[model samples]
Target chain A: MARDTAREPVKTGPDYLEVRLGIYRGMVRVRYFEKRAYDLFLQNLVKGTSHLAIGQEAIAAGVAAALRPDDYVFATYRGHAHAMLRGAPMVAVMAELLGRENGLMGGKGGSMHLTYTEGNFMGSYAIVGAHLPIANGAAWSALYRGTDQVAVAFFGDGATNIGAFHEALNLAATWKLPVVFVCENNLYMEYTPIRKVTAVERPAADRASAYGLPPVLVDGNDADMVFETATRAVGLARGGGGPSLIEAVTYRHGGHSRADPGKYRPDAEVAEWLAKDPIPRYKERLLDEGVAAEVLERIEAEAAAEVDQATEQAKAAAPAHPGGLEREVFSDGGATWRR
Target chain B: MTYREAVAAGLAQEMARDPSVVLIGEDVGAAGGVFKATAGLLEKFGARRVKDTPISEQAIIGAAMGAAMTGLRPVAELMFADFVSVCHDLVANQVAKARYMTNGQVSLPLVVRFGNGGGLRFGAQHSQSVESWLMAVPGLKVVVPSTPADVVGLLAAAVRDDDPVMFLEEKALYPTSGEVPEGEHVDELGTARVRRPGKDCSVIALGTMADRALAAAEQLQAEGIDCEVIDLRSLVPLDMTTVAASVAKTGRVFTVEENPRLCGWGAEVASIICEECFYDLDAPVRRITTPHVPLPAADSLEDAAIPSAERVAAAIREGLG
Candidate 1:
């Protein structure tokens, strides 16, 4: 089993307190946005399918807080939280889910492929384990250009068994590229439990030694611990200490997608994870740390209001125009294959 | 210059001109290349630019896509065209659709070069023409160079272009010598070159089949049959204008293909010819391709499987009749 570093006591200081509040606010924003997305999906406002990160907010929030503004982030389909935390406009993200012309990708990407280049959130890949090597490529470019920028790739625990994951890790370790691979071990891969399919108990961390990387596992539910682990990993990568694989053990609150009710999971397991929900746990932590209840309430209210505004704005936007179908396929701004 | 030497020269020319161009693949550094096509590049460019990666095609192509997304213009090589299946997701799904999916948020200015086609009896796994596989995919520029000159010029063009290009080098033609243009040689991507012009029939081919078509055209000329040989340098940016014009003049068309008969690149060309040049064509657009089966290891069987000069001439002559 990977070492549990979630038991470390929270540090106390004015600066630390401020950072903690920011992390908490980020988590709240994600929780509200995801819940709104769920509602939107139910109303048929969200097209296709959406993977919600309702219970897995801390990994995205903590990792985003640890990264620099210019740092690149490559995320998977379940990436609303990652994109929002990296400063992607909430309205644009909502519009993308709604498949609107004013969406992040002009409705071309939809929910699974949200990309805000301005925020350095490179892209959200739909294919499993596809973006890991691409993340290495971004890190390689930074190294080649003599920039201190690092690339971070977010994937699920299921990605550990895929060939691209192993291939990416080996290549990153070999080249010593400035990249951080974070695995949000949300207990399940789609509908099935990851442990039932995987050979090892700790899917990602156990494979670290094969690539000459140290096994670093942390509690995905604790924003403070994830932030600290991410900060160290990001600093090491930026300083040319090579790639780091961090297995963040967490659980998903709902099913895999809008379609799944996730009834395959035992009711007891679901109840247990719901009780340890990161948002309420962190709020309790803040209250216990001598922080005012009004501040926490204000953050929650602000997050809810932001989600509400974004929802309205997305609903008002028009569907993508059919005339622009052949545009932007090439750098020439045309999809013509023949002369 | 030999076709193989032109590969290195084209890479060197681009690397010298553009500081952003970097080469990465398995055994591409100190070991030169498996086919020596990338010889002397490591010595000239140094380790920072010329990198040797592990045997991971997914990582190689993925890294190339990632680097291209950021800033660097990466030229990645998969040892064999057949190996594209190993990293098909990166090629077909990720790299191909990324630009369009992101609504042009990212531009993939990269090249994936691979040894393609069968002649040396490498059998099913190592010997396969994959141009047809990529032709079906969108957002990819497919370049198949027959001669050394086209290899050098087209490669330079592919590197400079701000889109993902699949540079398929016919491995059999690597030893064949041809005159390459000196200093900065860049050819247009979508244009087809008419190697031999005629009035009786239009013989269209790609990569290795282009040379065979030219040979077939020469053979048919002595028998009172004038064949127009059109070499399709780039498949994606297909020069249908040139093809349509040739078909109008000749009134007869035949496609020489190395890929299997089923869903080959020739099928697309045939469909286009029938659609646009149906009235101009005197006969049906005949596609003389390899049989729909895995390439055999035996010399005679492999030779029989792939379309030859005789087969192309016979098909055109029979069609013209």
Candidate 2:
């Protein structure tokens, strides 16, 4: 397969082109969903902070595509894209953001904390690298049980420096458990740039060698490139090739969360990344192929309509509060009841 | 089956039943664990299933959580219960809270088993009973089984449970023999069992302390003081009703725990008893527990730090007097 990087767009695997196209559509769904979420935040339709997965949807769509229904996945706070692409009902994801009873978590987890068990998206952790150990534990269990299930943990560049990331990687490497650590290196940790946070600058995947694991860096913004790399890694893990570290090098187009306007980053830096938007780049590739221009427009329209429906469903979802919060704690039958 | 044998059996049986239940910890595969709690696991399940991990608590727990969340059931053995501090966040914050925080989306279903409390004189670092600290966490289900039957029953229950469970098997009780019924069994959390019923007083005990309570109750029975001994099998979901009912019936209560006295597990039970059953009590609730000091290295000093049968018998008398 030739690498498509011209008027014909980037060369993709001809055999799996539809698979790539399907994933690209999922990416567009996430892209538009996040954009609508941002709009809702502006209108105060959502509560708490919304972590935008903008410019990073390709990573979620690509990685989640290769995972089995029973496989485990853990993500950071900016996890709407991961949850949605992993097959979490769009209604619940939107309802969770709206803090409604019909949400995936019944409104207990608003944005940073979202979970969908049916899709195997275990949770989107609010605490930086804390989910690393949990993901490791789940993978360890799968390997122990003799099943070839793999656990995929997603985090930002800032999390790489935390003790949990180091500890999880070291243990996963030592035990040779089936786990994949995908670091969405979006250049900045909230406001501080990656260079200012850690001494390592090449890519987050470079640190995998320190733990004796196979590490790879890929073009995070390209949906086809990300899909190919993730599929290879997922295949290797399911085949008992131990664990791998994938550093999807991309950029976050928005601020850290809903609160910030990203004033710290220069306008030119933002503009440069916007020019390389994942959705448009993939659309260009499809147009160059036999895909019709009308089809492209139809897909965009469908994605927008889906996003609008999810938003409306979220707005109409019921409220869940103290009662739902009390159910998951302690297995015992009785405890204090907060009215 | 002995408590130790029961644990090994539970692991072996779970491994055979589910392809997703894996046992990993230091010395767990070949060495059969430090306490020999996993004697034939490696041979029966193979190295891939029964793993011996490096001495990294954080890594071991983190990996276990990862495995469990991803659709596997991981049973991790921390060499000693005292070592739980090394990976407290994974248990308390991550594993314990993940399910609740995620609104019941992720169920840890992870079993963390280890020997707690002192009888072998391993000193402060290795002998501390820190189950109380874990009981405070909301998402964790704390199970401290005293007998082989309870161990087998509770182990099965914890394995099947969707929430993260902390199964604290007392080091002293592991070698002690007891009858565990054949086949699979399960015991629910937060239900206290009455070992020996009496009418005069309630002797509340947890873990190995329940054995001492039974001994004391037998001795006190000869002395014409009938005592009802309650074994608090689970701490997190405490059966306060049983304790309160016993206190209401006898009008006197004596609590025993191997852990220290100050801010210990006993304090929580004591407070609950005083709050609910104080009106029916004839005497103040007395606790026979370890002193507010680190577990001593010397056997004699260790004896002083931990509660004994004699100490429990005397506390029962004090409460009766």
Candidate 3:
């Protein structure tokens, strides 16, 4: 079957105005949400560890915008932005960090494991490359059941070194499972730089040929580029072209977590990445694209207000229920299941 | 029917009953499993449900988790229990905790079946029993069935269970045949049965150890020391009701295990016996298990390393003395 070209999201296409604006709005919301979450974490309101995808918003916003609502998404620990851009309610996202009952995962998962099953988002995994094979399996389930709903796994550059990454890609391609492996190359594996740990000159895209899959690269800072690459990959998998790897060359502007200040990163490198910050970069592009300054400013104001309201609602929400905590040990959700 | 056939029968029954039930492993489909336990399943169910996966334990288990989360009852087969070391993260961290961490929004209806134990002399690497490793994991239910009938019924129940279940099938007992009951016989998870009842002493056993204990009890009957042999089919949801009742009746208890002595699951049973049935016991809970040592290759050395009927009888005689 011929791949559906019209399904791809284009920046300069006839629908550019609405498409670009949606991407721009999502990036802004993610930026604001991460900042608000960090500020709340400072006040000790958000418990546990939180990994903010602050500067890497374009990848999440762009990749999420490329897929259908029924398509499955599995992301890593740095998944707040990924969850939000996939249409997860900001209040629920914030509630999860606050350990409230109204959180995305009933607060049992806290910040790291936020899931929106209704949206087909499988949520974030703390273990680096753990979700890769799982994502392949979800795609296998879709294929086994004869559905075209492709699955996507979002991970960082560090995860590419893990054994699971090799195993998942190998199995996914070998079985022709309908899945996309998206590597958000944020340049650092926690405090250590990727270059210091990675063996090759670049990430292992050259090795993808072993799995009978294509290796594609895109500018992570450019939302339109990410969208285009992801759209093409998702389409290929849906059309039975097997799996694909999309290397989104990106950077994270903050510390590894809430505690580290990232002193290991040189000032020139930090300044270099900060200048490529997707939100401001895209906002400038929107203004240059002839969208009125007031219109862009209004979108920015709305994002801030929505995040502020979500923060307040999250703070006021009740704590997660303690009753029947024992029953959570084993699943009671399904005694007998069928497709 | 044989224990191996029972495993295949249970899997076939479940797959025929539910369209979502699938089997994934190395050589499980075309090869009909390494032990031929899944013999003819591929031809019956087709390759889609009875999948022959690459030799990747992580992918096999991880894919099962994903399939289960998205509404498939996946039965993943590991070639051996020792390879669980390779699939540990997916089982211990991912599949086991998903439902609880998600607060019941997700369910993992998955069963992991693997061949375990050291009696057949496959040597140290392939012959180790690792049920204690899985028993410590909270979200997992560990099961070990001795008889062919019990293996058939236990597997059906495990396939239907919502939680992740580890079904350890002893390699030596696969060819052993017994009178298996008719269809739709699903045994409850936490139930135990008294193989042979007596009043003077209670012999608690798990998996193939139950066979040895029963043999030992028969020999003890000739010696005029009455013994009650009990088969503990499930480990995680231990049948303490039957254990306590037996202990109360006999006032003497002995635990026979194939696993090593140190920190074995038998420790938990002994501790429970001490706590709940302390007044009912006339003797301290005696454990007849393999000594703390890695199993060597020679048949004689391997036999010495593991518990036998004679070894168990010795422990019983010592306890009675």
Point to the candidate with the largest lDDT: 1
Q: What's the TM-score of candidate 1 when only chain A is evaluated?
A: 0.96
TM for candidate 1 is: 0.98
Which regions of candidate 1 deviate over 4 angstroms?
Answer: A1-13
True contacts kept of 1: 0.88
Candidate 2 chain A minimal-lDDT segment of 10 residues: A1-10
DockQ of 2: 0.46
| Runs of candidate 3 exceeding 4 Å displacement | A1-6, A10-16, A333-339
Looking at model 3, give its docking quality level. Answer: acceptable
Q: Give the TM-score of each candidate.
A: 0.98, 0.88, 0.96
| DockQ-better candidate, 1 vs 3 | 1
The TM-score that candidate 3 achieves is: 0.96
Candidates' C-alpha lDDT: 0.93, 0.82, 0.87
Worst 10 residues of 2 chain B by lDDT: B98-107
CA displacement after TM-score superposition, residue B232 of candidate 3 (Å): 1.4
Root-mean-square deviation per candidate: 2.6, 4.3, 2.7
Clashing pairs in 1: none
Chain A alone, TM-score per model: 0.96, 0.91, 0.94
